[model samples]
Target: MMLLPDAEQLLANLTERMRSGVATDTAIVGIHTGGAWLAERLHHDLKLPLPLGTLDISFYRDDFDKIGLHAQVRPSDISFEVEGSHIILVDDVLYTGRTIRAALNELFDYGRPSSIRLAALIDRGGRELPIAPQYVGATLALPSDKMLALEKSSTGKLSLRLYDKNPMGHEQ
Candidate 1:
């Protein structure tokens, strides 16, 4: 596993993209796990006025029946109004796009947004849905057996890595 770009670079790119769009009253929302990790770092960097929102797509996932329930489920947290708010959704990686689909469903539960843009640390391509990330730190192309993960150090640093995972669901 190798460390890719650090959080500072990622935040720079994200802020640039958000600036180009000129979104007003922007809010940041991050999916649980890896996305949440990246979001925390971004919130500090961007200094968004609204509180950071978190979405756990576990229950909203389409593969819930096949993947079963995750042992650790973190609830979605969005206290402020979402309607007409410019929401910048953050995620660690953008791949099959299923997670974003689930996240959108969970997001509407809070309220509809004026615009929903996505930001990701890595875009691995191979999207199953029509989703796309407006801001991406890097792009990677890996084999089907390979997977990506983002780790956050206690000192508030972000690291990206590639790993191997069994797509068959036969290996844990």
Candidate 2:
């Protein structure tokens, strides 16, 4: 059995690093689902002045034609101006980089930002595209058949879970 790192501690470390490095004008935007949850904590802990943004990225996914729409699709929301502002794109895991690509496609639709930095809770080693996280809480390696996921409790505690990848190429 693979021993996972503590999600809460990892998050605390990530927030501290971001607190010192992020630009004053930087905006935090989380990808839907897990990313959104992490972003919420980061935004509050970092004390960012700008409103938090969340991206669904469902429609922007490159494999949209193959997978079609997801069951729970939330609309992307960016209340602040995107042009000329620095953006910290948050995600739970950085794996294939395809999700980041889709997020970039959706973000540009709002307007070009001055800069965009990726922040991931975990950085798994597989990379199908050239993408890297500027800030990472942890780096873990696991078998191709296993998947890592972040879970949040009703009281807002965070934890990590390992699941066997479904044979159909979907997460359980």
Candidate 3:
């Protein structure tokens, strides 16, 4: 069994790294689900001025035709201006980079930002694309068959879970 690292500690470390690097005008946006959860904590801890934003890249996903719609697709919420503002796109795991690509495509629809940086809680090295994270909590290597996920408790505690991917499940 793979021993998982502490998610709270990882987030704490990631927050510190982001604190020094981000500009005061930087806006934070989290990918839906795990990324959104992480972004919520980071946004509060970092005390950003802009309202927090989230992306639901379901429609923008390259595999939308292949996979069809996700059961729980939520609308993206970006209340602040996108143009000329620095953006830090947050995600729970950085793997194939497809999700980030989809997110970028969606974000541009709002308007071009001055810059967009990536922040991931875990960087699992299996990249089909050339994308990478500027701020990361941890770097891990696992078999392709294994999956890692971020979990949040009802009381808002965070944890990591590693498990075998279903044989029929599509890769993220």
Cα error, residue 128 of model 3, in Å, equals 0.6
Best by lDDT: 3
lDDT of 2: 0.89
lDDT of 3 at 37: 99
Model 3, stretches more than 4 Å misplaced? 168-170
Stretches off by above 4 angstroms in model 2 are 169-172
Q: Using alpha carbons, what is the TM-score of model 1?
A: 0.87
lDDT of 3 by residue, 24-51 (tens): 6889999998999999999999999899
Give the per-residue lDDT digits (tens) of candidate 2, residues 11-61: 998998788887568899999888999999999989888999999988887
Per-residue error for 57 in candidate 3, Å, reads 0.7
What ranking of all candidate models by lDDT puts the best one first?
3, 2, 1
Ranking by TM-score: 3, 2, 1
Worst 10 residues of 2 by lDDT: 163-172
